[model samples]
Target: MSLLRAGIVGCGAIFPMHAASVAASGAARLVAVCDPDANKLESASQLYGCAGYDRLEEMLERERLDVLHLCTPHYLHPPQAILAAGCGIHVLTEKPMCIASADGEAMIEACRRHGVQLGVIFQNRYNPGARLIREALDDGSLGAIRGARCSVLWSRSDEYYAESGWRGTWSKEGGGVLINQSIHTLDLMRWFMDAEVSRVEAQLANRRHPGIEVEDTAEGLIAFDNGVNALFYVTTAYSHDAPVEIELHGEKGTAKLTADQAVVTYQDGTVISRDRLPQDAMDYGGGAKSYWGVSHFKQIQDFYRSVSRGEAPVIDGREALKTSRMIEAIYRAGRTREPVLL
Candidate 1:
């Protein structure tokens, strides 16, 4: 079969992973890229040997792309995906589906109407640590999940936001640490619980950064419909980007995970652990940060397989909206100081 043609938008920091993944995939080809920045576009065009455009519409019209990857700012996801859907092009977008649940719903509906796939990139799910924990829970090795906790304590200096025009804004990047950095953890929490959220009680603050319009820190308690409770805390005020940690306690055991490793200890004195493979073993040649994990390629390949089989990708719009709803609930709960129902 001929490889599917793929086009990526936004040649920013995250572009390399997407570009390299598509370039390496046997099921797809990187035929085009789009970005408003001329230097980035020209560089990517030269490096990838693909056409680049300053406008998305022009790229869409010029390239016969089967799939379009959105690596753009958070606010641009909804409209861009919808536009691609209208063109009968499948969309694979980076996380936090959109700033609001309604927009996510629209994006999903648009893709459905166009008969196209809409996948969200939650690559962390493919991590060795995540896979082990998910298997333990899925196979009843972890018994009934009682509660969970996760944290993302990473630093983002003033210059980090100052350099990126959309980094700290509510209108573009959505919310600060919660939406930007910790949403992946939130998604993983929900995915592991495999339960609908009942409500959330949360608080948001800008403890360190004074000029930003969004929160630099957030803490929340989420109640799941299955009676499992989760506590989440995130802050971008630390001295460095620490490894994110998630711990799940269950009737049979407790499972703890960092970015590269996971440990599960059962009540009956059995302990299991999984560690990330070395860089060479993973065959990941991209320049993405180590903490980002090496699963973007895995997830992209899965999406290609799903499309080839004419099925929805694992983290399709609806699946991803589960976390988006949770994020929105946390934001509302933070604002009202009351439990917001999902």
Candidate 2:
């Protein structure tokens, strides 16, 4: 089988991961990369031995790519995706999907009109540990999930945000921690519960990084349509960096997963725990725990299979809209200091 030809936009911090994934997948090849910065393009091209262009149009015209991965800043997601779709290329955009619900809708419409597949990079949902929890939910082992909580209490130094031009700015990066850092956890929470958030009440604060234009911390209460309630807390200001933890409470049992380990306790006196059973690592800045980079590869391979089989991608554009809508509702709730209904 011929490998899928992939082109990537925005050769920034996350570009290497996508490049590595394409290289490792064997199902796809990084044919080209596009970035506004000549230096970034040159460096990434040299590193990956792929062609690079300073503009998307040039790359598209030159490469005839089978897939276009939008690894750009938050604000660029919608436009880049639309353009990619228009060029008759499937799109794989990094999440938050888009900065707003309207933009996400626009991207979806563009893809539908062009008969192109659009997927968001919510690789956390692809982790084996996460999939196990989902399996438990499906089998009713978690039984009538009552409530859930996800905490993305990770810390980011000022230098981390300073590494890029669009790091902490609202116009470029959308919101702060909630959009950039906590979005994966938020997506995971929604996926694990398999519920749509019907309402949200939130409070956002610039508690630590006053230098940034967006919230550094946000807390929200989410009510799912299935009568499941969840509390979400995300902050980049924690003094001690903590792993993102998601806990699901059920009538028969409760499952807690922190850093890719699953612990479950049941009403019938069954307690089981599983450790790092070949799960994708979170994209924390290099460490023993880093797994985000490789997971992108897994998702891309899945996308290729979906394309070949003429099936919907695992995290299709429409499915991705749910996460973006919830995010918008949270922001609205935070701004209005009241519950926002879906």
Candidate 3:
């Protein structure tokens, strides 16, 4: 099949990764980039040799794009995705899906009505550690998961929020560290457990960054429908970023995961360990970070192939909505200091 034409919205820190992923996919070519900031748009356009637009609608109308990648802020995802679906363009958006569960559902409905594919970026799921844990779980080597725990100890300074107009705001960013930075780890936790969340009890705090309206720290207990529970703690209040750590306790044994490595021990004392294969140098763009994993291209390729075959991408809007809803429940539980039923 011919290469699918692609356009990316929001020329933010994450856009470079998306741009590189699209270019490396071999299934799609970058055609345009959209951003409200003229400087950002111009820079990306020049860098990628693609058209630039200050308005999303203008780009959608002017460019014959088969896929639209949403690299914008959390709040813009649902509306931007719905708009692209209305134009009959397949959408692949960055995570959290949207700020609210209702918006996520609407985005899913729009894509379904338009008969276009909708995929969400959860690159961590493609990490070597995540893949290994998932394989063991599926093969029954990990046995039944009895409990799990994950922590995201990353740092974000006051200047980090001061530099961006929307980063610290509740309305724009949806939430703080939990929604933006730790959501990927949360998604992986849920994916590894392979169960629906039944309840969430959470607490939110602004431990360090005072000016920001959103929390810089959060901790929670999530109960799955399958009689399993997981504990999670995420904070940007640390001195520096750390590799996220996740552990799963099962009937057979346990599995521990980090960004690039996994260690699994079976009941019979057999142990297996794996580390992520080195990534292509070309895939690391300006925004690329080691903690972000090097699998954006993998997901982009899968989305392109799914769109080409007229099938749903693995991380479709509905699949992503599960995490989105869980996030909303977490926020609610955090604020009310009560357990929320999902």
Candidate 4:
């Protein structure tokens, strides 16, 4: 089998993870890196031993890439991914796909029209704890889920926003905590529940961040088709970052998870606990430990395998749309102070 050629399109804090994953995966080879900053590009080219380009068009023209990772900013995803897809290259992007659903839909539609894969990065779903929950729920070991809660209480100092100029802005970084930090939790919640969200009621606030237009804190209730109402709360205003918490109550039992562990108990007096890999850099707002999670390698490898086999990735654009739509609903409900029906 031929190796799938891969190129990364950003040299930010998260770029190395993609490069490392490409090195780690047997299915792909890293061919190039791209960024607007010549300094960052120089560093990336040196680090990865690949060609670096200041222009995306130049990279596309020169590199025979089979896969392109959009490690770019939130606002830059659509156009870049669309361009990659137009060139018949599979596109994988970091979370939130885009700040808005319409843009995400456009990306999805374009990939569909071009017959290439479009994947979103929600690596948290690949965790052992999350997989345990999904397996139990799938195998009927969890019976029926009644409700659930997902919480992400993490801190983001003023410096965190100031350093990343696009962050905290509605148009660029999208919403603060909900979009930037907590979207993984949102994706995990939907995956664990395995149901469609029917309605949403939410409230958003920019209470603590000093210089941002987006909400720093957001809490909401999402209702599913089976009458399972779930609660989700996220904020970057906390004094210290905390591990995310997810719990689900079901007819037969309950499942609770944190960054390190997962526990599921059945009504028959049986309990199951699974050890999860340590949560790394992205867990605490991307400062010193940004490359912390091991799931990136797992997901990246899976993506290439899927592509090589002509199968959709586990977290395809359509799979991401479920969480993206819920995010839009939360924002809409929060701004209007009314329940938004999905």
Measured by lDDT, the strongest candidate is 1
Candidate 1 vs. true structure, TM-score: 0.97
Residue-wise C-alpha lDDT for candidate 4, range 1-342, written one tens digit per residue: 888889999899888778888887888888999998888899888877889999999999889799999998899999998999999999999887988889999999999999999989998888788888989999988888888999999998899899986888888887889888989888899888778999999999987986988899999899999889999989998988898899999889999998747999999999999875444323323242653567887888889888998889989999998898889899999999999997
Candidate 3 TM-score, true structure as reference? 0.98
lDDT of 3 by residue, 85-191 (tens): 99999999998799989999999999999999999999878777788899999999878999999999999988899999999899999999989999988999999
Segments of candidate 1 deviating more than 4 angstroms = 279-287
2 or 3: which has the higher TM-score? Answer: 3
lDDT of 2 by residue, 74-168 (tens): 99999989988899999988887898889999999999999889989998776666777888889988789999999988788888788778889
After superposition on all C-alphas, the RMSD of every candidate to the true structure, in Å, is: 1.3, 2.3, 1.2, 2.5
Candidate 1 clashes between residue pairs 3 or more apart in a chain or in different chains = none
Candidate 2 Cα deviation (angstroms), residue 178: 1.0
**Per-residue alpha-carbon lDDT of candidate 1 for residues 29-95, written as tens digits (9 for 90 to 100):** 9999999999999989998899989999999998979999999999999999999999999999998
TM-scores for all candidates?
Answer: 0.97, 0.94, 0.98, 0.95
**Positional deviation of 282 in candidate 4, in angstroms?**
14
TM-score-best of 3 and 4? 3
lDDT of 2 at 28: 85
Distance (Å) between predicted and true CA of 180, model 1?
0.8
Residue 185's lDDT in candidate 3: 88
Model 2, residue 164: C-alpha shift (Å): 2.1
